[model samples]
Target: MTDLAKTDRPRTPVLDRVTLPSDLKGLSDRELRQLADELRAETISAVSVTGGHLGAGLGVVELTVALHAVFETPRDKIIWDVGHQCYPHKILTGRRDRIRTLRMGGGLAGFTKRAESPYDPFGAGHSSTSISAALGFAVARDLGGDPGDAIAVIGDGAMSAGMAFEAMNNAGHLGKRLFVILNDNEMSIAPPTGALSTYLTRLYTGGPFQELKAAAKGAVSLLPSPMQEGARRAKEMLKGMAVGGTLFEELGFSYIGPVDGHDLDQLLPLLRTVRARADGPVLIHAVTKKGKGYAPAENADDRGHARGRFDVLTGQQAKAKSNAPSYTSVFARALIDEAGRDDRILGITAAMPDGTGLKQFAERFPRRTFDVGIAEQHAVTFAAGLAAGGMKPFCALYSTFLQRGYDQIVHDVAVQGLPVRFAIDRAGLVGQDGPTHAGAYDIAFLSNLPGFVVMAAADEAELVHMVATAAAHDAGPIAFRFPRGEGTGVEMPERGEILPIGRGRMIAEGHSVAILSFGTRLSEAMAARESLSARGISPTIADARFARPLDRDLILKLAAGHDALITLEEGAVGGFGSHVAQLLADEGVFDRGLAFRSMVLPDRFIDHDAPYAMYDDSALNAAHIEAKVLEVLKIGQLDRRA
Candidate 1:
C-alpha cells in the first residue's frame, strides 16, 4: 500500500485493506458486502473535509468495487462518463492521501484525468461521452490483437443526450464486445428528462410483468410441443407489453437487468456473468440511489448535486463568510426585475437553472422559463421561436455550453436576425469546473456570427448595464457574458441604462502602451495599471464592450497613439483577441511590427482549481499582465521590490 493510503488515525478496513483491484480476488462474497460498508464510510469522511461531487461518489461505491474486482483496471479500460463519480475510483488507484487536495491548485483533479493517473483511461468533464470513447478503445484493442474488455459506465441522466443515442446506434451496428453499464441513479443535476427518462420510469414500474412471464413459461413447459408453441407465442406477446424491449433491442444491443446496484451479491455475480459472455454490445442496467449512505446528502432537495465543505453529522454547508452578493444571485435578481416589468420577457437554460441563476425565474414564471435538459441546440432554437412569436426571450446558457449551439446561433438566431437575448454565465475560466465548463469559446463563436452583438461585463455595475443593453436592443441576437462566483462588490446603479454600441470607455490613460481587455479580466488589467504606475510606467487601460463590432475606432485610435497594444481576454484561440489581430492586419496597424501578445487559455485543458489560482497558472493574472506590458515596452521585467 502507498503511504498516502495509510494514516495513523483509526481508519475503516474495507477500503484500506485493498490497494489494487487484484486484492479483491481473495475476498469472499460475504466480505465484499462488509467492504462496501467501510468504503462508503471512508468516502463520506473524505468528502466532509474536501467538498466535491459527494452524492455521485457515494452512489457508485458498491458498483465501483465490483467492477474493479472483476476487471483488470489500468490494463482493461474502464471509462467513467462525466467523471463526477470517479472519486472512489481515484481513492482505489493510489491517490488516497491527495484526496483532501481535490479541486485545489497543484493538487488532485476533481475529474478523471489522463495526465493525473494511468488508471484513468480517458479524461472527461462533459456528460454522455463515455460510450463513444470506450468504443474507440475497443476498436484500437481489436486492431492491436489485444483481448482486453472496454467498459463504459454511463448514468441514466446522461442517456437523455442525443450523443449517447448516436454512440449506441453506431456501437450496435459495428457489433463489437464492448460493455456499457447504465448507472441509473434516476437523476441528472436535476431529475432526468425527455423520452429516455419516461422509458426508465416504465422499466422501474413494470418489473412484475417479467415475473409473471417467467411463471407462465414454467407452467407451459409441461404441455406437448403444439401446446408449448402456442404458449410461447402468448409469452412473446406479454413481453411486447413491457418497455425497454423495443427501444434498446431495435438499437441492436442485448439489454440486461434493471438490477439493484447497491447489492454487491447481485452486482458481482451479474458482472461475472456479463464478463464471461461473448456477446456484442450488452447493456447492464443498474439502479442505485444518489447520496445512498450519507444522511445529510440523501435528504437534500437536490440530493447534494454540488456541495461545499459540510458538517458530517449536521448537514450544514461550510462556506466562507462573504460581504458581497454572488454574481449569479445578482444576475438572477436582475432577470427577475426585467421579467416583472415586461410581459413579453421569457427565460431559457440548458439543464442548469440553479447554476445559471434562472431558478427564481423558473419558479415564478414557469411557463416563460424553459430548462431544455442539456440540449444547447434545442435551447437556442426554442428561444428563437419565442422571439418570432413577439416575445423577448433570454437564453441563459453557460459560455462553454453555448459551444454546442454554435450552428444554432448562426442558422436559427443570427441568419434570420431574431432578437434573442443571451445571458452567458461563466464567461471566463470558471473555478474548479475547469476548461470543459469554461466560457472560453463564446466570444469567438458569437462574434463571428453575422448579426450577433457580443458584450462582456467589466464589473457588477457594468453587468447591470449590459443586461439592460441586451433587453433594450431588438436589432438581433445579443449576448452579455459574465464570470462565475461573486462580483467586484461595486455599488450597482439605480437604473440599468443602455451603453452606446460599438464603443469602449477608458479606465486610465497612458502613453507607453494601451491594454485593450475584454470580459472579467478587466479587474486584472486594473491591478496591472497600478503595478505599472508604481514602477514609473504609465499604461492606458480600456474595457472594450463589443467584441463582434471590435470597437474598431477605439482600438485603432489606441494603436496609433500608444507605443504598443496589449490584448487580453479569458478565452481560447478563436475569441476576441484573434479578431483584434485580424482587424490590425487589415488596417496595417502592425505594418511596423507592433510588439503585442494575445494572452489566452493555453492549448491544453486546465484542471479543477480556485478561479484565482487558475488565472495565475494560465498567465491571466495582474502580475503577468503587468510583466507582459513591461516586456512589450522593452522595459524588462517589473521589479517586485520597486
Candidate 2:
C-alpha cells in the first residue's frame, strides 16, 4: 500500500468543489483530472462503508468523469450497462449525500435506477442490455420523444452476451445516431470467456497498441496536422483488429479506440471529437484495468468485483464467521461428489461459475464444466443438447438470471423432454442486490411447465439429497432451488440419498393446524411451531420438497388431519401454495369447511436490506407465520410486534 492507500478516507478537494455533472463544465482539464482521482478515492471509501461493486467503479473513474463532462446527461441520456459501475456516477449525479446508504432499505439502489436520479435515464442490474436501451432512446429522440443523444457505457463482459450483438445489429441496420463506449477491462465478474475476448486481447497485444498515445492525439481533428498521418496508420490498425473493417464499422458505426480509459487527456479529446463531429453510431473501445488505483483490489483475483463491508486500510472484509457452510457450497460439494461417481455429469454456468459455486466443479472436472459467457439462453439450450446426447447436465444459474433463458427452458428442454438438471441458486430474496436480482419467480414459472419436476431445499442436507435425486432421475427436466446464505447448522451426511419423487417428509406431527413449508422457510415454520406449542397449539410441520408434483399425498393427508392448514415458501404467490390450493380445490377438500391460508412474498418488489429485514417486510418470517396461524385458527390476536 502506498501513502494514498494508507489513509482510509483520502482528501477529496476537487470532488468537494462540485456535486453534479454540470459542475465539470467550468473546471479546466487539469482540475477535471484531479476530480477523477478524488472521485476514485471517494468511490473506494463509499464502497468500503456500503460494501458493493468496487473494481468496476474504479475502472471507470476517468470515463465517468469524461462522460458527464462531455455529454449533456438527463437531456442527453447516458445508460450504464449492468449498473455495477455506477457508484461514481451516482455521486456526481447529486446522490453523494446518500452514498453510504446504497443498497440498504430506503437508500440509493446499488444499480442505476431511473427513479433514483434524473441523470439515470435507464436502470440496470443484469448485464448486456445497454446497447438495445440506448438504441431505443436514440429512436425515441428521432420520433419526437425526450430529445437527446443516447450513449451507453458497457463492459467487455456485458458485450459478450448475445443481446449486445442483437442490439448492435439492429442499431447498424437502423443507422441511428448512438454512442457505445466499451470499457474493456479484460474481466467481468469472472474473467470474461469467449472468442470475442480473445479477439479483444489480440488488439491489446498487437504491435500498434504501444503507439496509442500518439495515435489517439492524431486520430481526432482537434490535434495538429502532424498527427493526421498517425491517424491514418491507426485507422489501418483498427481495420486489422476487426478483420474486414473494425467490428463496429462493419456494424455501421464509426469505431474509435483501443485508447487508455484511465488517461483523461486521451478520453476527453476523443469524446469531445465524437460528440462534436459524429453523425451515425459510434463504438469507442477504451482499454481499462479493473481495480485501477487501489493496490489491494488490483492485486486480488477478481479486482474487488464484489465485497462485504471492509477495512479500507488492509482491504480485509468484515464478514461474520458462520459454522455452517452456505447453501451454494453444499450444492457445489454435492455435485462434485456425484460427478465423481458418474463420468457423464457435466456442469454449465452463464458467466457465474463462482457466484453459483460451480468453480470447484470446473476445477475438479475441467473438461466437463462449460462457462457460456453471460448467455443464459445458450447455456440452457446447450445443456439440453448435452442431456439429449445421454449425458447428465446440471445447468446452474441464479433464479433471476434464469429468467433470460425461459424461452430456451420451455421449448428446448421441457418440450423436448430432455433430462437437464437445473440447479437454481439464489432462489429467494437476495440481499443488497435488490429487486432486479431477486430470485422470486422460478417456482411459479417452472412449476407451470408440464413434465418439469421442481423442488426446493428445506436445508443444506436436503440440497445434497436433491442433487443426488436430480443426478439419478433420467426422465424429463428436474430443478431444485436453494436460497442465498449459510444453511442451518445441521450435521453433514456421508452421502446424499436419491429421495423419492413427489414425496414430502414430515418433520413434526401435532393437532389442530398443520404448517407445510416448501423451501428454506421450513426453519421459520418450525420456529412458529414452537411459539404455537406454548399456547397449547402443536401444529404439524412438513417440508414439501417437490413443488411441481404437488407432494399430493403429504398435502392431502395434512389437510385431512388438521382443522386449518398453512403453506410457507420463499417465492411469490402462485407458487407451491397455489399449486397446493389447486389440488385441494380439485379434490373438494375446501368444500369440507377446512380453513386455509398461504404465506408468501407480497405482490410488490422488496428493496435491498438485511435478508431478515426484507423477509420481515415480505411478511414471510416466523412471526408472520405465527400471525397467519392465529388468524386462520381465530386464536391468539395478531400481534407481530409482540
Candidate 3:
C-alpha cells in the first residue's frame, strides 16, 4: 500500500490512457496539455510517498510528454543527464506500476539504469555524462547498431563540468544528427555556478515582460489558429525573440529555443520543427523552473532537489529525528573550530557546500570558503594551488565524486607533495543512491599514493581529532573519511586534538583471535566480539586508524601474539585489508603460525537499500564478523566440524 490511499489518488484521465509512450502518439495537442497537467499531479502523488527528486521531474512533465509524443522512443534514444529528473520519464516508459518503489531495495533506481528498460538507452548517475553517451548512441546508430535518433537532456549545472564541453566539442566535430536539450532550470543539486550559467540566464534576461508576451502573440499568425493559440499563453511567443545560441553555435551545432519548457505549445512545435528539419547536431535551449508545478517545491531553497517521504497536502516530511549529530555536521563544526585557531585555514567543495556541511563554514567565513561549481577536477587542483600558496586548504568532496579528479590528485597534489587536506565524505556503501554513488574506492586509491596519509574515524570524536590533525600537519596530502548519517552518540570534544600520524588504538584485549578494524566497521567488530564472548571466545579488538602508514608496531604486536587475525573495512578489495595482508607477508608473520583473514565489501556493486540492509548484503555486519572469527579459530573450527 502506498502512503496515499487509493481514494485520495488524483483523477488522471489522460494519464490513465498513457500505459506507454506509444499510447501518447494519438492524443491531440490540447489533450497533451491536459496530460502534462495530470502527469504533474501524478508525479507529485507518487514522489510524496517514495521521496525522490520531485522538482526536476515536475519541471520536465510537459517536456517529457512532448518528447514522447513527438519522438519514437525505445528506438530514438533519450538519455537523461544525472538521471534525477527521470521520474516522469520512467512513468511514461511503462514503469509507473513500480513508480512508488523509487530508491527502495530491489525497486526503481533513483537515477537512470540501462538494465531497467529499453527506453533508457544509456545509464547515468553522475552529472555531465548524457552528451557523451548520446553521441555514442548516434555513432552506433550510424554504424549499424540499434537504429534511432539520439538526444541528450543535460542541465545547466552539469554543463559546468569540463566533460560536458568535451562532449559538445566532439559532437560538433562528428556533425551527426543529434539533439542536445539544455534544460536551464537554474539549479543542480546546488545552485549552479560558473560563467556558462550566467551566460544561459542572459538568454532571456533583458526582454520586457509585456513586449516578450506580445512577441509570443505575434508568432500565432504563423500557426494554424492565431486567435485561440495567442490567447492560450503569450509566454510561448517569447520564443520568437532573437535568442542566439552563440556558445553552442561556436561549437558546431545549430541552436533553437529559449522556449518555456512547461508550455506544450512551445515545446511541441519547437521539437517538431527541429526533429523534421535538423540535419546536423542541434541544441535546443529550454528555459524551465525547477519544481515548476508544486508550490512547496518551487518555494523550497533546493527546489525540492531531494526529499524524504512527505505529506502531499502539507509538504511535511516524516523524517525521524536523531539525537546524535551527523558526521557532516561534526566535521563542519570541527573545521570551523580549527579555522578559528588558524587564519589560513580555508574550506572548498565542488558544488556541494550543503551536502559536505561547508554551508556552515561559508556562513561563518564567506571569503575563506570556495564552491567551484560541479568541476571536481578544478576544485582539486585549485585547492592544491591554494595549499602551495601557504593556505591550509581542505578540499571536501564525496568519495565517489572525488574520483573525477583522481588525475589531478595524482599529478598536481600528490606528485608535488602539497599539504592539501582531503575531507572525503560518504566514504562507504552509501545507501539509496546505489552503486554509482557508493564511496568505496577512495581508500584503495588514496592509500597507495606516496606521502598520502589516510585515516578513517571510528566515531565522531575521532573525526574531530583527525580534522585538527589535518589542520596542524603542513606535510604532504592528508585525508580522513567518515560515513554518511549521524555519529554513534559518542561524546564530542570542544576542540580537536592532533593525533600522532600512522598510529593505531587498542579497544579491547583477548586471546586466540585479534580483530583489527579500520573505519566505521570498528563498531561492527566490537559487536562481533560481544557475540564471540558468549561462545567462550573473547576476540581482541583494535582500531587501525591509519590505512597508509599501517601502525607497524601495533600491527606486529597483534599478529605475533594472536593465533588468528582478521582485518575489516567498509571499502572493497585492494583497500585496507589488502594493505594489512601485504604487511603481514612482508614481515613473514604468515609463517609464524598466525591465521589471517580480511573482511571487506564483496567485489560487486550492491544495489539501493537501507544502509543496514546493504551492509548485511555485503556481510560486514556483526553476525558475519562473529562467524568469520569462529571459522578462523582452530578449536572453534574443530568443534564446528565435529
| Colliding residue pairs in candidate 1 | none
lDDT of 3 by residue, 16-113 (tens): 89899999999999999998888888889889888888988988888999999999998898999999899999999999999999999999999999
lDDT of 2 by residue, 547-586 (tens): 9887888889999999999999999998999999999999
Greater TM-score among 1 and 2 belongs to 2
Candidate 1 local lDDT, 315-361, one digit each (tens)? 68898877777778778888888788887888888778888889888
lDDT of each: 0.81, 0.89, 0.87
Q: Count clashing residue pairs per candidate.
A: 0, 0, 1
For candidate 2, give the lDDT of residue 533: 78
The runs of at least 3 residues in candidate 1 whose Cα sits more than 4 Å from the true structure, single-residue gaps closed, are: 1-10, 207-237, 240-244, 592-595
User: Largest lDDT belongs to which candidate?
Assistant: 2
- Estimate TM-scores for all models: 0.91, 0.96, 0.94
Rank list by TM-score:
2, 3, 1
**Residue pairs that clash (backbone atoms under 3 angstroms), model 3:** 216-237
Flag regions of model 3 displaced more than 4 Å: 1-7, 208-243, 635-642
